[model samples]
Target: MNDLRIYIHIPFCKQRCSYCDFVTYDDKSYLMHSYFKALDTEIALNRQYIEKSNITSVFFGGGTPSYPDAKFIKAALNKFDLAEDAEVTIEANPGTVDFEKLSIYREAGINRISFGVQSFENDMLIIMGRIHDRSMAIRNIKDAKKAGFDNISIDLMHGYPLQTEEGFRNSLSSVVDLGVTHVSCYSLKVGEDTPLQSMLDKGLLPEIDDEKDRNMYKAAQGYLQANGYIQYEIANFARPGFQCRHNIGYWVLDEYLGFGAGAHSYYNGRRFSNITVLGEYIRSLNELKLPEDYSETIDMEESIKEFMILGLRMTDGISINVFSQKFNRGLYSVYGNEIKDCIDSGLLISNGEKIKLTQNGLDFANKVFRKFI
Candidate 1:
């Protein structure tokens, strides 16, 4: 049986963050019941795939999964025949969940909770338009532990407007002190059409300097590594044996099925995603039709390129033997010149069995990724 991973997107949030451009609705709480019904229908419609696969992971990612009732999460999970040790995770916001709600989620089989604690500084949180203050963030982390989550992850951001290197380090220290098992630190990017971009345009927020961003990134890497967290992926760090398996599956190109609005899926070399708009997703499901907006089969060349790009995201990099076995082509035969160029530029290093990014390459990851593209 195929080892399948499942992702369910909850497209409801109490409010949108300044830097977010994801497909989420801030005022759609009233549609919660109908949306859950549509999701259940979508799951039932995909029952054939579910039965033949050993569902190994389930992730509830979203606008704010904790904003809705935990029972809705349970309702979606009931449709799958999960493996005995599935890594079930839910993404939550700090201000939305309490001890009782989180405890109920634990009972509903959520083994991991990833909180969106962007920064521990109240000023930075305010700048980012986060709903929770630093105190609430700390309280939520403690409550997650009290509610029986041994595996916890929190996201921290750096390189944003008004955020100093010292402030970023302080946030990292606070997360480490919280004793969470995993940490994902992302550098803030001012995405186009986001409120952050508008602020930058109007000079309401200072433009982040490239050199400062790099320095902050290096600081985070150094601090986390010294504090017993292993840099398993470029942006993710974890204690021993606590790396996120679901995210690792994505890096390794595992077959995954995504449900609900705006969710994407990859199975048997085919890639597809559901409709992004909530109303359209619900309408299609209510009419007994699949809400797919796009689908395509990945060809050999595209697959090889994706393998290199995604696998290279991991700190351990890609295995040459596995690549050869999968594609029936030696890695060097196809991209020997590119690999040689990257190595000569000190962007990549190879110890014969595998190839991975060097520290400098991590700093210029976009430049390295562009080479493959």
Candidate 2:
């Protein structure tokens, strides 16, 4: 059977974070029943395609997956005949989950829990407009552990407004001390239309300097590496075997099916996404139709470019041999000049077996990626 991964987007949250631009509704609890029904319909409609594949991982990502009752989560999982050892993960907010809810999740076949604990510092959390305080974040993590979640990951944000290097380091240290298996440290970016951008525009929040942001990122990379967390991906660090399989699938160009509103899916050489509007998504499912808003099959050139772009995100980089084997053409035959330029500029290194980013390249990854584009 073909290896496959699945993602379910839950677009409900108790409160939206200031920097978030994901499609989510805060006061849409009244739509939960209908949403789940639509979600179930979507899953069932896609069952035939997945039935021939060995489902490896299923991720519940969202506004706040754990904000909903466990029954809703269970209902979603029930639609799939997942592999026995599948890594089922649910994204949760620290303030939205408790011991009871976590226990329900554990009982419902969720083996991994990823908490959106942006920071362990109250001041930082407040500035980010996070719903949970430091205490709540810590308490919920402990609660998740006690509720039988062995594989836990928490997201930490760095380079927030008014954040100092010391503060960012402290946040990393605190999460490391939590004994969690995985850590995803992200630098704060003010998205367009987000409250954070408005804050920056009105001078309510200070802008992050480029040098300071780079320093903060380097600090995380150094600290996490020293503490036995491997930097498998740019922003993700994990203990020796705890890398997020679901996300790794994406970086490796593995096929995945995404369900629910605003979820994107890459499968059968084509990419598609569901409608972002909740009402439309539900209405389409109610009409017994797939709620896809857009889809396109990528041509060979676009596929090759995307493969390189996504593969370069990993620290191990891309294998030239694998690229040639998959594409039926030599990697250097197409991008030999670009590769040589990057190497000469100290952005990439190749041992002739694989080509990967150097430390400086990691610092200026965007510049390196643009070369492939």
Residue 93 shift from truth in candidate 1, angstroms: 0.5
For all candidates in order, the CA lDDT equals 0.93, 0.92
Question: Model 2 scores what on Cα lDDT?
Answer: 0.92
lDDT of 2 by residue, 205-231 (tens): 788788888899999999999999999
Ten contiguous residues minimizing lDDT sum, candidate 2: 204-213
Error of 1 at 131 (Å): 0.6
Provide the RMSD of all predictions against the true structure, rounded to 1 decimal.
0.8, 0.9
Q: Write the per-residue lDDT of candidate 1 for residues 1-373, one digit (tens) a residue.
A: 9999999999999988898888889988999999999999999899999999999999999989899998999878888888999999999999999999999999989999999998999999988888999999999999999999999999999889888988888998999999999999998866679888999999988899878888988998999999999999889999999999999999999999999899999988899999999999999999999999999999999999899999999999989999999999999998898899999999999999999999998888777888887
